[model samples]
Target: MLTLAAGASAPSVATQLVGSGLIGLREGLETGIVVMILVAFLVKSDRRDALKWVWLGVAAAVAMVAIIFVAIHFGTSTVTGLAAELISGLASLVAVVIVTAMILWMRKAAASISGHLRAGLSKALAVGPFAVASMAFFAVGREGVETALLLVGYAENTAGSIWPLVGLLLGIAVAAALTVALYFGAVRINFAAFFRYTGVFLVVVAAGILAYGVRALQIAGWLPGGSNLAFDVSAHFDTSTWYGTVLQGIFNFRPDPTVLQVVAWAVYLVVVLTLFLRPLPAKPGPERAPLPEPSNIPAS
Candidate 1:
């Protein structure tokens, strides 16, 4: 999408807008889930005071992302050719690491994430507002940083940075609106199902990012075997064409790839898919023991 949009003869302004909007949808959905979890904890615990902390965390994360963008934009201009390539390549590599960790963690912890968040909230509440804010900051900050890095990588690899960013923003807006609706019971979605499917989709996307990062490193001379073209399909398909543009934007498809790029893409898919497809352990059911009354326990 980014590549096609970045191309000289890709599409009209409206097409770019729609493409970016879809990208935003995916990005926003991911962020929305985290926000939903945070808000749910606040409402469940009756900790309206803690809500500010959540917003603080979100603001801090956004600020950090902006800083990154400014730094990259200015830094790229200051550095010479090789140096600039190295910086961008290294950044992409770092993004791959962050994205990979997030995927694996989510895969392993998806079943119990709610419980973990609840426990963290309990601890945060015990420590007062500052601690609550810090907790929220860290939680959301993790996701924000990952999103920022991924977006940076995407922007660097593809053409037309602003359009992709626009898409991302639109996605976030839609996701946020949907989340708010869900919170108020105005909307209903099978969250478990949604996460499950999206999780799979994310894994595929991460694989493409990993491949892209490796290619960037090759271009920067940080990796070897860049000279050899893995395969050429450009004779049959021009990436600048309408169908090609759509595929390029959504899947990061390139007609020409280096040997290392192909290998990296394949390895990523194999490893991630193997782990993703592994059957999860069955969750234990809730205990049947009688609950203690709220009045019976001493107040903190």
Candidate 2:
């Protein structure tokens, strides 16, 4: 949607499906893993009753996100021009910040996250099902909200909401099916590889969004020097041309980019990618030697 909104052509259904499928696959796998971990923990502790709480939390989170989406949608309808631009720009910036934080958190604490979750769940279960549900709600809610915000931005920009939304729904449905399969040990995929690649893709996508947001601000006349055309490729390739349209849809590519937009895009890609690809810090060595039983927590 971000791509389309930035003057890119509308994508075919196949392309939307593919893109949404990838997103769904990644997100679904993460959620699946979390649920699996909870189930496993419950089984180990003989606390099957707590599973209900997890479901409650998931439902609550979904509802909360839905409410937010509706509010933003209706609110945007009443606002025009600069107000709409500011809203979208601010939302994009918030998404960028949240995504950045999430990436950093994953990098710094991936190894210990499972352990922390297990500890929290153990405590929550003792407090009853409500506590369990709250934990689950928050666990899933964070991912859900982020996905919703990003999708909304995409929808607004591309004017291709119907297809993308359909694609997103389909992707999620497939993911849910796969989750069930995973529970039965009927499917397996290297999650580490999946996250690594998707993380890189998301970084690029987010950078494009950041650039798009800046352009929006420029359009609203909030940002300076937007009137000056940095360069023009309209002579060689019109925006309506097949190649131009495709480039626009895929990467939010503009033949004529402003100085600020170009600089923002370049700097974002270089800085974010460099930081994202850097080697993570090593975990500290254990103080004690071997234990009688092995730990369930996996090493990063």
Candidate 3:
């Protein structure tokens, strides 16, 4: 049993667990969707022969991500004290940026991703197998790296060690199963609505992460005024309480946060939430195969 001193509390284990799970679910679903789209396009086009190459590319991407994850794990373990804090702060900031971009890009791209992928498939088919394989690699590889970055950031901040990893693994497993069902037409989801809600949730999560990044920087002495907190609610609200765990789990909530942390959190939430909730722009989708290039249609 770990002991906490006066006005000192370690991170909640449950919070880390659920937070990591959400990240895993979101990231896993995106990766699954990309692969599903590629596979579906090939099948519909009667290009079943190219499926092997696609799978190969996906495998290669997975292997690359696995290697990177392992390397980071070992490397972070060796880092300690101020160095670890500095690295974590920077990494968390990067993760927030990537996640924010992903959420916004998905908002715009979700509507046209299928069409764009199909068009890309058509072009890839015109090229060689290498191009097809490379296309799949790039598509899947991107999501894989993004997923890894999210996990890495979470891992860096977690004090409960393996609890976060367990949640992430469970979420990913659930996501994989969901993807398979969706691809086989056993399940149908309103992806637009799904993305909208999840995007909002992720924006909130990113704000929390960004604030935590500032906290980390302050702890590392990379930023001044670590002790200059805006308020100290710890006297009245104990983080060991049930509600505290809930808040901390969902939003990384702290009782007493530095002025910089509060400012960063507030500005991020207001700016990003407003931008994310704005209406999506209208646009033409992937040119629609040029209307079959009508010249000679068998001259019936």
lDDT of 2 by residue, 180-216 (tens): 7766667765554566788787677677677777787
Ranking by lDDT: 3, 2, 1
Candidates arranged by TM-score, highest first: 3, 2, 1
lDDT at position 176, candidate 3: 90
Q: Of the candidates shown, which would achieve the greatest lDDT relative to the real structure?
A: 3
Comparing candidate 2 with candidate 3, which one achieves the higher lDDT?
3
Clashing pairs in 2: 5-157, 53-133
**What would the TM-score be for candidate 3 when compared with the true structure?**
0.86
Worst 10 residues of 1 by lDDT: 289-298
Which stretches of model 1 miss by more than 4 angstroms? 1-23, 73-80, 286-300
Q: What is the C-alpha RMSD of each candidate to the true structure, in Å?
A: 5.3, 4.7, 6.0
Q: How high is each candidate's TM-score?
A: 0.83, 0.84, 0.86
Off by over 4 Å in 2: 1-11, 238-246, 284-300
Off by over 4 Å in 3: 1-14, 284-300
Residue 238 in candidate 1 has what lDDT?
67
